[model samples]
Target: MFIRTESFSQYIRQYPVVSTLIALNVVIYLLSLLPFIGDPIRNFGVGSNYMIAQGEYWRLVTPMFLHAGIMHLLFNMFSLFIFGPELEKVAGKARFLTVYFLAGIFGDIATFFVYDSSYLHVGASGAIFGIFGAFGALVYYTKKMLPQLRQIILPIIVLSVVMTFIGPNINAAAHIAGLVVGFLIGLSIFHPKRIISWRKPKLKVVQKR
Candidate 1:
């Protein structure tokens, strides 16, 4: 389906939250590359499979901002550029941000279970995928309104699934986890009754002639 929302920059002007997130991810990635920048940034990454054992709960949130490399950052940022704005338009700034962090943390939680905590897991892909998941959720409940998107939904999902297989460090577990949580959040937020009521249909009664 065609993109019905405003352009990304226009959306940014209206809803600056998504722009801030993308900017943060880019800034962190650039910082990670700087030689003088040391373990302070490195410590933000999901370090060595360790859980809350030492009370490092911030790992849940910090990993979403850290990236393995420039390529990783770019891929995730591109995904956000494409999908984040529309979700923000539909869900509003607060809910949109909620979807991002909830999905990201859930994705990281999935990583904790799937990968070694000792393994360094980093990147915004988890959050990006969560946005994709939010899109999928909208496609589910709003199909009547977004019928055009119904046709493109499959191809979009296929592409994402294919991308997950591309690299050894892709962190599909986190991506898939983000998708699931985002989908559920979408369902909760865009439930058919609430959204349908939002568009409140007017039934006109015609007298029998």
Candidate 2:
């Protein structure tokens, strides 16, 4: 169930918010490639040790936007492009972005606290993982409406869990933490009842005298 297919876009115009995010990430990646700025930018990567240690805590949130390389950037952005629009369509732009940023922040914070020493870490994986979490919450909330999505839902969760164990350069722990935090946050903020209430606001009509 690749949401990037023509069928998904057939009825829904690409969410401007998500598209803009994708564009911004790409632009940032391009900016990081400039020679003068490239080295510093990659090291700073949304979170640099100096900045982080100096109590520029926002680095936790910012790091997720910076990718270490082209392949890293592409994979993260492509995953976001594929899964994000649909999640935004379901969850709305503001909420989706909130989860994205929060998840990234939490992921970095978790990694920072657990690791004894600092390492250069950057990428949208944390945020992308958040998107996956959001998708899980959305599917669970709308199980009655989206029962067909279970097959899609289960595999993603399973795959993510599996990837965490298949050790590599990937900060799978951060990804896991981000996903869990995002899922919990999404679940709390976007419960089934709240969604129904949000969707069905009482309309006020006024007649001109």
Candidate 3:
């Protein structure tokens, strides 16, 4: 009999950093299920307008990493997995992480300001939108090379718009805010680097022997 090995590790190596982030988010969510930690988890991300208004400003960012249920977490993670690797490869790990967190914060802050005292919200859509923003920026910047990206992205944007109107308990403000912030940050990353002139080396021809 022949032995066969199976491992997704090799496939994941191309995006080690993104994998790490996904792992961290999953771990944190799992931890939130414990009886002792469950309530505290709500404080971190329940989207309670009251808590947010009461000066728990940190909640805006925290909520992005925390989800309300298994389905919620899975959906967000699925989207992240689908889109994050490409964006991370383009933006680089550090910048990609920055954009994710900033977009999440933007979403949270927008929710905090827009929703009333009774409503509470939580999910990773904000960060996902940020990734979408970066994707749009990438398509725009590389229009010469990848004009097709715009066409692909346009349908997704339209679907998201329709979802905002039809989906119940959706936080439309946060989504818009995250998209704007992500786009701005994405655009900023493309600014031309300062040029540095290099001294030319002189070459001399040797006399034929």
Which candidate has the highest lDDT of all?
A: 1
Of the two candidates 1 and 3, the one with more favorable lDDT, higher being better, is 1
* Model 3 alpha-carbon miss at residue 81, Å: 0.3
Model 1 stretches astray by more than 4 angstroms: 1-11, 196-209
Clashing pairs in 1: 48-117, 48-118, 49-117, 49-118
- The digit string of per-residue lDDT tens for model 2 on 1-209 reads 55566554552466777777788889989988899987776665666555677787777877777887888889888888788877777778888888888888888887777654556578878888888887787777777887777678769878977887785788775798889877887797679678778879688999999
- Clashing residue pairs, backbone N/CA/C < 3 A, model 3: 47-120, 47-121
Q: Give the TM-score comparing model 1 with the true structure, all chains together.
A: 0.84
Native-referenced Cα lDDT, model 1 = 0.79
Estimate candidate 1's RMSD in Å: 5.9
Please give, for residues 1-209, the per-residue lDDT of candidate 1 as tens digits.
23536676676797588789989888877787778774668765653357544678788788888877777778788778777777787888888999999999998888878876465688777787888787788888768887777667657776887879895768888889998899889888888777767688789999998
RMSD of candidates 1 onward, in order:
5.9, 2.7, 7.1
Worst 10 residues of 2 by lDDT: 3-12
Native-to-model Cα distance after best TM-score fit, residue 159 in candidate 3, in Å? 1.3
